[model samples]
Target chain A: MHTRTLAELGDALAAGEMSSEELTRHFLTRIEALDPRLNAFITVTGEAALEAARAADRERAAGRAGPLTGLPIAHKDIFCTDGFRTSCGSRMLDNFISPYDATVVRRLKSAGMVMLGKTNMDEFAMGSSNETSFYGPVRNPWDLDKVPGGSSGGSAAAVAARLTPAATGTDTGGSIRQPAALTGTTGLKPTYGRVSRYGMIAFASSLDQAGTITASACDAALLLEAMAGHDPRDSTSVDAPVERYADGLDRSLEGFRVGVVEEFFDEGLYPASAAAIETALDVLRSLGASVKRVSLPNLALSVPAYYVVAPAECSSNLSRFDGIRFGYRAENPRDLADLYKRSRGEGFGAEVKRRIMTGTYVLSAGYYDAYYLKAQRVRQLIAEDFRAAFAEVDLIAGPTAPTPAFDIGAKTDDPVTMYLNDIYTIGVNLAGLPGVSVPCGFADDLPVGLQLIANHFEEGRLLNVAHMFQQETEWHLRMPGGEFA
Target chain B: MALTRRQVESIANLARLQINEDEIPAYVRNLSRIIDFVDQLEGAGTEHVHPMAHPLNMSQPLRADEVTESDDRARFQANAAAVEAGLYLVPKVIE
Candidate 1:
């Protein structure tokens, strides 16, 4: 019951073999027993979950069940949930019980999915490793010593450990994909504006996107169908038609053109991870995908460019957390200036503050053009590179992270090393393309992720490709202590 | 491109963040390295390249100017640190 995918769970519920309330209690029991070891959850709404499950069961009995009815899923704390404390894994928002539900939350609830609880994440969705989380790091379920990746680490870890069948995650530069890579989960970051950003805590407005982490791409398709669409509340939300995503799965990958980025296999990548992805590409080839090496000349510049653009946007977006209106406030401020400074200083974590300051400095009077403007131009070049490459190929494939998960403290000292982990995944966000990370093979007994990227609004095509690969390979089905270890 | 202690201090002030004195050196070091890192973009050949603000190159969409939302001022203010007579209270700005 715990290891079943969303489809299997849905079938079981539809067949009247088990009640949603019983299924929810099963997962709730597992979470209570296992989540303490992983630190994957911030708050577990057991009472609310049971209540939602009971309602779903009652509705199912009355013959009104949706595809997602009675399925329990966790949401990364970044999204606001009415009445639940949407901490966003930050001290500033520790006590913030949102008055409204994020569009994603509302949509999923309407689909009859039971909200298990809010999963932990990096503070303000900033770091590449979950260590920066105010709730503490989420350890990889495969190996407790290594990180699960971030800022969506908690969601990834939760999904991987079978604490939940699926979970919601947000990616700004590789938060969703990287964690999914390290934890051996299927993570997707849809094209920018594909998922409405309304009520999701802002990180980098342009790059940030809500996505899903599940046991497989099939589950991703099911959940994404319920979540994708436009909401007028988010100014940047694209007014586009939602795809019947699950309907497009089970398609064959015959004659698919897969492009391998020449730069992604450079000297910095881990050899074992490279080996894993190479074999996965061969599996794609057997599934009828023709492979060719492609180039994105500005690929190496993504980290630097993203650092500038993301931080600048975050600095602007995070300004709303000033102590007066809501969130944490410094105690006993001597004056207005001190209130502003001390409140911001105390509320934000080190990485958040560092990003804020970097953003502040770059957008400052003398440095704006050199840092911010040049970075934006380079971002344009990066997008152009993708544009030129996608002209010849249907999809791009690579290893999601340079390697599998790293030691918790390994890259904390130098921020650059941590920044480089997303070296492969960030370029997609810069260009606002859809990308996914599916479990391919193992490195050092840990799982590796094979990344698949497509042009903008090509989420359906990407999901179909992933589903085909998943059909040919059993990597996505390998669970902890099943075969690898 | 390395920032001095004073430069980081001033930037923190500009951002309205109260970074402590002991943390200044680390900020100077990391911020300098990051700034230096982005400096590589200086050499990229972006001649006549228009800086991209949106990924899809779509202009901000305009909607009909009409009231689409109802007033939820009291509900929204429930999380405020201090509130009075339908308003948020903050440190006094005017003398």
Candidate 2:
């Protein structure tokens, strides 16, 4: 039961083979036994999960079950849940019990999914490795010594370990896809504004997007179908029709034009991982996809531009954490200025503070045009490059990460070196295009992910392409045990 | 491209973050390297290009000017550090 994909689990529940309560208990038991090994979960709402499962069983008995009814899933600690504490992996929000549910949480609950718990993440979703998490780093299930890439590391680890069938994650510059790559999970970051951002804690307002980490593209399609749509609460949420993504999964990939980015296979990628990506492209070719060599000339500038733009936006967004209203407050403040300073300095982790200061510097009086404005223009060039490339191809493909997961403490000393981990994935976010990282093969006994990017609002076409690849390959089904041994 | 220590201190103040004296050196070092790294953006030819603030180039959406949410002061105040008489308390400003 624990090994089954979300789609398989839903089918079992629909066939009356097992009750939702029974299925929820099965996962809860696995979480109790395995979660300590990975530190994937920050909070486990077992009692609430049982209660929700019972309700789902009652709904199924009443003949009103949805496709997601009774399925258990975890949420990255970023989303606000009414009763559960939404920590956002920060000491500042460690004690915050939100007054309402994030739109993503509300939608999934209405679809009858059971909440297993809130998974851990990098503090304020800032770091590439999970080491920056306040709840401690989530170790890769495949190898205990390596990181499960972050800031969506907890969700990726949880899904990879089969602690939960699926988990929700937010991507801002590869948070979802990078971690998914390391953990051998299927991760999707939909086009910006595709999923409403209401009640999900803000990281980088323009770049942030809610997505999923699941066992297969099929499960991602199911979740995306339920979660995608406009909500008036989030002004940026696109007022576009949400497609029935699952219905498009079985579409043939014949005549599909795949453009492999020439820059993605540059010196940054490891030889083994590059080989894995090449082999995966062959599988796509065998399925009748015509491979074309393409180049997004401005893609290399993504990291530097993202560092400027994301921090600039985050510094503004995170200003709400000032001591007076909510979040952490310094004790015995001598004045208002001290209250604000000490509260933020003490509350935020080092990486978060570094970003806040970086933003403050770039957007400062003398440097705004030199740094912030310059970065924004480069971002435009990168987006324009993607537009040009997509006109000639139906999809773009590349490696998700440079290599497999690395040691936890390897890149923490140098922030720039750490930021480059998302070299292949960040360009998609800069352009607001949807992208997914699906397991392709293993390198050094650890998993490598093949990233697929689509033009804006092409999530259905992207998922269909991925589902067809998954049909021809069993890479997504392999678990993380032999490597552990 | 490296930021001076004084600049780092001023930036922290602008961001309203209290950095202890001992932590200043590390901040100066890390912040300098990051700034140097991002300075590569200056090389790109952005002279005639329009800057993109939004990803989709969409303008902010406006809504009808009506009271959309009911008063939930008590519920919201529960998360505040100190609240009295239905108002958030802060350090006194004027003498």
Best by lDDT: 2
Shift of residue A394 alpha carbon in model 1, Å: 0.4
Estimate the lDDT of model 2: 0.94
Off by over 4 Å in 2: A482-485
Q: What is the TM-score of each predicted model, taking all chains together?
A: 0.98, 0.99
Tell me the deviation in Å of residue A159 in model 1.
Answer: 0.3
Q: Pick the candidate with the highest DockQ.
A: 2
What does the lDDT read for residue A454 in candidate 2? 97
Tell me the whole-model lDDT of each prediction, alpha carbons only. Answer: 0.92, 0.94
Tens-digit lDDT track of model 2 for A1-485: 87899999999999999999999999899899888999999999999999999999999999999999999999999999987789999989887889999999999999999999999999999998888888899999999999999999999999998999999999999999999999999999999999999999999999999999999999999999999999999999999999999999988888899999999988989999999999999999999999999999998899999999999999999999998888899999999999999999999999999999999899999899899989989999999999999999999999999989999899999999999999998999999999999999999999999999999999999999999999999999989874322
Runs in model 1 deviating more than 4 A are A482-485
Q: Residue A275's C-alpha lDDT in candidate 2?
A: 98
